[model samples]
Target chain A: MSELLKNTIRFILFILVQVFILFKMPPLHRFITPYLYYLFILWLPFSLSRAGLTVVGFIFGLSLDYFSKTPGLHAAACTLIAYVRPFVIGLLISQEGADKNYISPSIVSMGWAPYATYVIVLTFLHHTWLVLLEWMSFGSFLYFLGKVIASTAVSLLLVLLTELLFFRKQKFRTNTI
Target chain B: MRNVFLFIRRHFNFLFFLVLQIVSLSFLFRYNKFHEAAFMNVSTELTGRINEKYNGIEYYFQLKRTNESLVKENIRLRQLLKENYEAPDSNRRLVMDTIRVDSARSILKYNYLEAKVVGNTTALQFNYLTIHRGFAQQVRPNMGVVGPQGIVGTVVNVSENYATVMSLLHRQYKVVVKLKNGAERGAIEWDGLSPLFVTLKDIPKSAKVAKGDTVLTSQTSSLFPANIMVGTVYDIVPDNASNFYTLKVRPATNFFNIEYVYVIDNMQFEEQKRIEDSTRKKVQ
Candidate 1:
C-alpha cells in the first residue's frame, strides 16, 4: 500500500481505538483519566501542511465528539494540538528553514528526549481540556491538577510504547539531500 | 511593519498553539448537563470495551462460578416471584424485569431492553462501565440499569444504539440512600480509589449510625427505585471537616465478572419527569 493509504488506515484505527476504546478508561487515578486518541494527531506525517494539520485535528475532535456524544471536545483539543504541531516539530528538527518531507513522529527518528517532550506537553494540554471541560467546577481544581499530571504521564507512556513497538528509526533529511 | 510580518512568519507556530488552546478551553468552560451526559455515554463504550478485552482470560475461568451463581439466583428469584404474587398492592408495580424468565416467573407488565457490554474497566480512580444500548433501544437518559448482581448504574447518554452507564464507582455518582431502618439518610459517592468501597456523604452527624449498617437507596433518587441494595456500612467517620457523617460502603455488585445487563424502563418515568420539569420551571 502507498504511504498515504497506510497512514490513512492507521489514522482511522487509532481514532477508533482511542475514542471508542481508550476514552472510557475509568479514572485510573483520583484525577487521571487516560486518553490515547491524540495519538492519531500525534502520529500525522511531519510533512503535512499547517492548515491541513489543523483541519484534521478539528475533524478528529468532532468525529470523537459525535461518537462520544460530547459535542465539541475532541475537535477543540485536536485543533489546539494541531495548531501547535509545527512549533513542536521545529523545536526538534531545526534545519534553518530547509523544508524536507516529514516522517511521522517516532522516538528513534525524533530522538527520545524530543519525541517524549512533544507527547508530554501535547497530552497534558489534551487531558487538561478533556477533564476541565467535563467537570468545570472550581471546587475540584485540585483533582483537576492531579488528573492532568497523571493522565499526561500515562498518555506519554502509551505514545512512547507505540513508537518503540510500531515505529522505525530514520535519519534526518534536508531538502538538498 | 516588514519586521513585524517577518516575525509573525517566523513564529507562527506559537500563535497556532495559542489559538487552538483558546478554542478548546472555551468549550470546556461552557460544559452543560448535556455535555456531561454525552461524555458519560462515550465513557461507557470506551470503558466497557477495555474491560471486556482485559478480562477475556479471567472470564473463561469464572464460567463455572457464574453458572453456579446463576443457579442459586434462579432459586432465589422463584421465591421472590411467589411472594410477589401473594402480596397485595394498589399499584400494578409497573417495572420491567431484566431477565427473560419462564412462565413461572413473576408476571411483570413493563418493557424489557437488553444491552450488551461494549466497554468496561475497574482499574481507575473513578470507575465507570459503558454498554451498547441507546435511544434506538428506547433507553432514555435517566433510566435505571442493572446486572445479574444488582444495580450497576443509570443511563447517562443515549445514541442510536449506544448508551453509557455512570457506574456506581464514579466519583460524581451521588444518590440519596437510606439505612435499613429507613429513618437516616445520606448521599452515596465513590472515593475514586476502590471499586469495593464507597463513601456516604452529607449524612447528619446526629443520625444514629453504626458500623455494619445496611445502606439502601432512598426514594429521593430520580433514577433508582427505593430500597435497592447499595452496601454495608464499613466505617462511619465524623466529618470534623463538615457537619455530616461519612460512612464507608461495600458495593453489593462486584463489577469485574459480568457480561450482560438489563435496562429498566420505568413506565411512569415520562409522567413523573414531566411533572418534575413543570414544577421546577414554575418555581424558577
Candidate 2:
C-alpha cells in the first residue's frame, strides 16, 4: 500500500481506538489516558522529514483537541512538540535528522536514552499547553501546574511502555558505518 | 524566486504535513470550538446509561453499605418525623406515602427527582459534581442539592439532560450560615482545602459563638430551604487581626466520602429568588 494510505488508515484506527475505546476506559484513567492518544503521531514514518513530522504532530494534536473539546489546547501543545522534536533529537543523538533516512523513528536508530528524552520532552510540552488551555486562567495556577506535571509524567510512561511492548523498528545497516 | 520554488518543491511532503497540522491547530485554537465536547460531557445520557448498567453491579457489591445507609436514613427520618408531630406512626406514614414527600415539610417543602451522578472530581482544586439531571429533569440553577447528611451544594449550570453542581468543597461555594442560639450570621466558604471545614466569614467579634453549637443555613440563602443543617460549630477562634470571629464548622453531612445525594426542589424557590433578585437590583 502507498505510505500515505497506510498513514491515513493508521490515523483513523488510532483515533477510533482512542476515542471509542481507550478514552472511555476508566481503569486506564490513571497514568494512561492523556498520553495514549499520541501513539499515532509518534508512529509516523521515518522519512516524514522535519516539517512533515511537525505538521503531522500539530494535526494529530488538533484532532485530540477536537475530540477532547478543549478548543485549540491540544493543537498548540502538539505544535510545540512538533517544532522541538527535530532539534531535541539532533542535540541528543548527534545525528543530522535533516539527512538521515529510516522507515520508523525508534530507539534502534536514535538510541534508547535519546529517543526516550525526545518523547518525554515533547509530551511534556504538549501536556503543559493543553492543560493550561483547559484552565484558561491563572486563578487556578496551582491546580493547572499539578495537572501538567502529573499528566506529562503519566503520558511519558505510557508512550515508553507502548514503544517497549509493541514496536521493534526495522533498522538500516548503514553499510559504510 | 526560482530558488524559493525549488526549496518549496524539495520540502513539499514536509510542507504538506506542516500546513495540514497548522490548519488543524488554527481550527481548534482560533475558533475555540470543541469537536469532542461529548467525551468531556459524559455528564448526561452517556454517563447516565453507563452508571445505570454499572450501578447494578456496583449495587450488588455495595449491598451491605447501601442497606446499612438505607436503614440509617430510615431511622433518622423516623426520628425527625416523630419529633415534628404528636400523631401516631400510621397517619405520618400516609402523609409521607409519596417518595417526593420530604421530612422537612413543617418549615419547607421539596420535590425529588431521581438523578444519577455522571461525573465527579474529588481531587481537583475546585472539584465539581455533575449529574444526569437538568432542564429535562426540571432541575434549575441555584436549586439545593443535599446528600443524606445535609446540604451538598447548589445547582449552577443546566444542559438539556445534565447539570453541574458546585460542590460544597468548591472555593466558589459561599452561603450565609447562622448559629442557632446566637443568631450570628457569617459567610461560610470552603478554605480550598478540607471539604469538611467550611469557614465562617464576616462575623462580628462580639458574637457569643461556641463549639458544638448548631449551625444552620440562614434566611440569607434564597437558594436553600432555611435551617438546613450546614454543620456544627467545631471550633471558635477570634480573628484579632481582623474584627471577625472565625469558626471551623464540621459539616453535619460528611462530604468527603459522600455517595448518594438528594436534590431539594423547594416549591417557592423561584418566588423567593425573584424577590431577592429584584430587591438587589433596586438597591444597586
Candidate 3:
C-alpha cells in the first residue's frame, strides 16, 4: 500500500480502537487507563519535519480530547511528546541509522532496544503531563504519583504489544563486527 | 528588525509549540463550566450524531439491565399513588391548599426531562456523559442530571440536539450535599480514584454522622431539587485542618450501569442568579 494510504488507514483505525474499544475497558484498578491512541504519532515516518510532527500531534490529541471531554489536556501532552520525540530518536539511534530514512520507528526499522527506549521516554512524558493536567491542582501527592506511574506503565505496555503484533520481524545477518 | 526576524526563524518550532499549547490551554480553561456555546465536545451535530450511532449499537447489550431498572422504577412510582396514602384531615388539606395558592399554586420548583444516555465514560479522570436531549429539547447547560437511583451530574455544554454532562465521577465535579438526618451541608468531590466512591467535605464534627447515613443533595443547590439521593456515608474522619469531617460516601448511582436519566431544570435559576449578581456587583 502507498505510505499515505496506509498511514491514513492507521490513523482512523487507531482512533476508532482507542475511543471505542480501549476506553470502554474497565480501569485496571482505579489508576491505570490504557491509552494507545498516541502511538499514531509515535509510528509516523521519521522523515517528517519537527514542525509538521508537532502540528499533527496537536491535532491528534485535540481530536481524542473532543471525545474524552478533557479539553486541552491531551493536546498539550501530545504536543510535548511530539516536540521531544526527535531528540529522543536521535539520542537512541546510531549516526548511520539517523542518516538513513526510517520508514517508521518500529522494532524492525530501529533495533528493538532503541525503539523501546524511544517509546518509553515519549510515552512516560505524555502520561505524566496528562495526569498532572487531569489533576489540575495538587490535591494528593501520593495519589498523583501513583496514577502517573501506573498509567504510564499500562500505556507503554500497550504500545509495545502493538509493535510486537503488527511490525515485521528483523532479518538475521551474519556477525560482521 | 532583521535580528528579530532571524530570531523568529531560528525558534519557529518552539514558537509553534508554544502557540499551540496556549490555544489548547485556553480552550481547557475557557469551557470548564456550563456554557451555551458548542465548542469541542460531544454536543456538536457531527460528534453527537456519531456518538448516537455508537450508542445505538451498544444499547442492545444493555437491554436486559435497562429493562430491569425501568421495571424497578415503575414499581416505586406505582407505590406513590395518592390512593396509597391515608386521606388527610379536611382541615389540613384546606391549609395545604392555602399554602400552595400563596406560593404560586405549587411548591415544585423544578421540572424533569427524561433523556437517554448516548455516550458515557467512567474510567477517565474527567468523565463526561453525553445525553440525547439538548437545547432543542429545553436542555440548557447547568441543568442537573439524575439517574433513577441518585444524582448523576450537571450539563456543562449543549448543542441543538445533544448535551454533555460532567459526571459525578469527574475530578473537578463538586456539588452541595448533606446528611439525611442532619441539615448541615457538605461539599461532595471525587478524587479520581474509584467510580463507586466520593468524598464529602466540610461536614461539621458536631454532626451525628454514622455509617449507612444517607447523604442527599442539599436545598442550597440551584441545579438540583433538594433531598435528591446522592450517596451513603461509608466512613468518616475529622479533617486535620479544622473541626470538619470528611465522610467517604458510596454513591447510590451505579455509574457503570447508567442508561436512562432525568435532566432537571430549575425554574427560578435565572431569576435567582440575576438578583445575586446585582448584590455581588454592589459589593464590589
**TM-score of each model, in listed order:** 0.74, 0.64, 0.90
The model with the greater TM-score, 1 or 2, is 1
Looking only at chain B, model 3 earns a TM-score of: 0.88
The CA lDDT at A86 in model 3 is: 86
Over B93-154, each residue of candidate 3 has an lDDT whose tens digit, in order, gives: 62235555577735557999999998888888788898988888999888999998899999
Supply DockQ values for each candidate.
0.23, 0.22, 0.59
Clashes found in each candidate (C-alpha, N, C closer than 3 A):
14, 2, 0
**Which tens-of-lDDT digit does each residue in B1-284 have in candidate 1?**
99999988886866665666565555544433334533444544554455456456546766886777567767878878744564355587555564556652444434557776655656543344567677766888777777766678877766566677778877567777888864588888876666778888877877777888888877677566677777788987655877788788887776776566778776766777899999999999
Task: Report the lDDT tens digits of candidate 2 across residue range A82-128.
Answer: 66666676687646642255555677777777777778776777777
**Could you tell me the TM-score of chain A in candidate 1?**
0.84
Candidate with top TM-score is 3
Candidate 1 chain B — worst ten consecutive residues by lDDT sum?
Answer: B29-38
Docking quality of model 2: it rates as: incorrect
**Model 3 misplaced regions, further than 4 Å:** A95-101, A168-177, B33-38, B41-43, B87-108, B238-241
Q: How much lDDT does candidate 3 score?
A: 0.83
Candidate 2 DockQ vs. native: 0.22
User: What digit string (tens of lDDT, one per residue) describes model 3 on residues A96-149?
Assistant: 654244466777667778878888888889988888877766467777788889
* CA lDDT of every candidate: 0.68, 0.65, 0.83
iRMS value of model 1? 5.9
